[model samples]
Target chain A: MRFGVVRFPGSNCEQDIVIACRYLGIDVDYVWHGDTDITGFDAIVLPGGFSYGDYIRTGAVARFSPVMGEVVRFAERGGPVLGVCNGFQILTEAHMLPGAMLRNRGLKFICETVPLRLERTVCQWVDLPEGTVVRIPINHNEGNFTADAETLARLDANGQVVLSYCEPDGTRAPGGSAPNGSANDIAGICNERGNVFGLMPHPERVVDPEASGTDGQPFLTTIVARLAGV
Target chain B: MARYEIFVTYKQGIFDPPGATAERALANLGYDEIESVKIGKYIRVEVADGPNERARVAEMCDKLLANPVIEEYRIVDAEGAVSAR
Candidate 1:
């Protein structure tokens, strides 16, 4: 299966995504932000890093990149789209996903491995069952997810909340559960149609033990399997 | 050409971390009775004068300058006449 990773002028993690895909034996190509075509790729990944120097706002400028128009069209045609970290921010800005990111609750940049729980949903990217916990690292200064009360309720009922922050033992405390103060401890979400998935953690950075650990392998392999029709 | 100032602030009930930090710092400096402080963005824009100029800028704010989900914006022209959303 071929995966196309979009590289904005300032994207720093596109190479890591290329590495992760290569490790899995998946053919991957770099899709420049200025390019408008995405004809052959089976999946599109918007990797992390400060795009457009995060000017105006994180992902705000990058959302208007020429490639985004093609990406949106691909998504409308049921192609799977994954946005990680700053890529997640761009998804929100482009209105492909719900909610905007506010500054982290602690008002500081955070970089650490946090336990993430998968909630079974319609997302094809995550094949893990509900309530599965994995260790993935999140690094961001503005990752707090904010949405209206009714929208949060709608997302939960529809099973669009794909992943969430949780305690190491797969449990959650009553208060302050999310490290970044995301509403309902939400770490990631998918669109209602279940084709677009966006998350704040860096799965590409943890695809193998050499990169730290292998907890992030399953998330990648499942989608690779889906695209390969395996 | 016309110049305008736009103020963007988080909507009510949304947490403002930077504003809260500043509020706490003020109290530590001996002002205990401070009610609250809000932090927001102040933007200046220059647009060529035309009909419906204020409305056009408001559209820009809705589309890009401000996130309507979390923040509200107000525009003030050179004459200080205010238009808010």
Candidate 2:
């Protein structure tokens, strides 16, 4: 499957995602933020970075990029889209996903690998069985996800809470295991339609065993398999 | 052109990490009498005065200057008159 990796002015992870995709034998292309055309791409991936220097708010300015209009239209048509880290922030800002990312509770930037439990397998990006725990690295200053009680309830009821921070044994981590103090220990989620997925962790960073591990391979391979109808 | 000062802050129920850290720092400095501390953003915008200026400012806040989902913004005219909140 061919993936379109979006490149905003400040996007730094586009190259990493491209390398990871190439390693998995998936064709990838870099889509500029100012370009409105995303034709011929099977899926879209918004890589992580401090777009527009995270000015005003994280992903707030980047959401207004010209390419986003096309991306929004693509998502509305049920196109598969995966947003990682700041990409997740952009998705929320674009209203493609619910909730907002707040600053870490300790007022510090955190970068580390944390265990994430696959809470639901309804999304295209996550094909793991329920309750599977995988360690993925998260790097961000504003990764604490929050939403109103009503929205949280709706997300839970719709099975949109796709990933949550948990212990190695798959126990939900209320305070200790959660690195950024995300609400309900949420690390990722999908929209109601399940075509758009957003996660705070960097799955692309772990696709190489020498760098970290291959725990992230499934996230990319799942898309390949889906597009191939395997 | 008229200048508008906008103040953006987290909603009442939302968490403010920097504000909380500042509050703790104040407490550590023996300022126990302080009730609370909330940090927010102050933005200055200049726009031409027109019939729809007030509405335009509100639209800007809603669309770009502030995120209505987790933040509340207040606007003040140059003369310090409360314009919109």
Candidate 3:
């Protein structure tokens, strides 16, 4: 399957997504933030980085970019869209995902590899089973997730929360799981339709065994597997 | 011309980390009377005066200047009167 990676002015992770896609034998193209058409790509990946220099707020400015108008249409059409890190922030700002981001409770920019547990849900990106703990890296200042209590409950009840921070041994603990103090330890979530997924961890950073480990392979390959029914 | 000033602040119950940090710092500096400190953004916009200008500025806040989910915005007209919330 082909993938499209959006390149906003300040995006720094577009190349990483490209390399990851290429390593997996997936044909990909760079979709500029200003470009409005994404007719050929099977899926879209909003990579990480400080888009629009993260001015006003993270993902706030990039949300109105010309290409996002098309991204919204693509997602509304049931196209699978994956937003990683800053891309996730953009998705939230664009209202494709519910809730918003806040500064880390500690008010620090965190850069570390954290343990995340994948929940059994309708998310189309990762095909892994419930409670699978994977090591992924997160680097950001505003990764704390915030949503109203009602929204959180709805997400929980609907299985829209596809991933959450967990201990290394795959257990939940108070205030220990979330590195950023995200509400309910949420690390990733999906919309009601489950076609769009947004997560804070950078799977592309771990795809190369030499660089780290192949623990992230499923996240990128599962789309093909699910669609092709392999 | 109609000039509007917007005050964007996080909604109540949303933790303000920077605000809390500063509050503590100020208290440590002997300002014991200060109860809290909240941080927010202040933006100013100028548009041609018209009947729909008020609605347009509010629309800008709803769409861009503020995220209504986590924050609220207040618009003040050039006369410094609170125009809309």
Q: Which candidate is the best by lDDT?
A: 3
Off by over 4 Å in 3: none
| Candidate 1 residue-wise lDDT, A38-109, digit = tens | 899989999999999987778988998999999999999999999999999999999999888999998989
- Best-matching candidate per DockQ: 2
DockQ score for model 2: 0.86
Model 3 gets an lDDT of 0.92
Give the 10-residue window scoring lowest on summed lDDT in candidate 3 chain B. Answer: B76-85
User: Which candidate, 1 or 3, would have the higher DockQ against the true structure?
Assistant: 3
TM-score of each: 0.97, 0.97, 0.97
Please, what are the lDDT tens digits per residue for candidate 3 over residues A38-128? Answer: 9999899999999999888899999999999999999999999999999999999999999999999889999999999998788888778
Residue pairs in collision within model 2: none
Local accuracy of candidate 2 as per-residue lDDT tens digits, B3-73:
98999999999999999889999999999997789999999999987998978998999999998889999
Task: Specify the CAPRI tier of model 1.
Answer: medium
Model 2, position A86: C-alpha lDDT score: 93
Model 1 residue runs over 4 Å out of place are none
* Runs of candidate 2 exceeding 4 Å displacement: A174-176
Candidate 1 pairs with clashing backbones: none
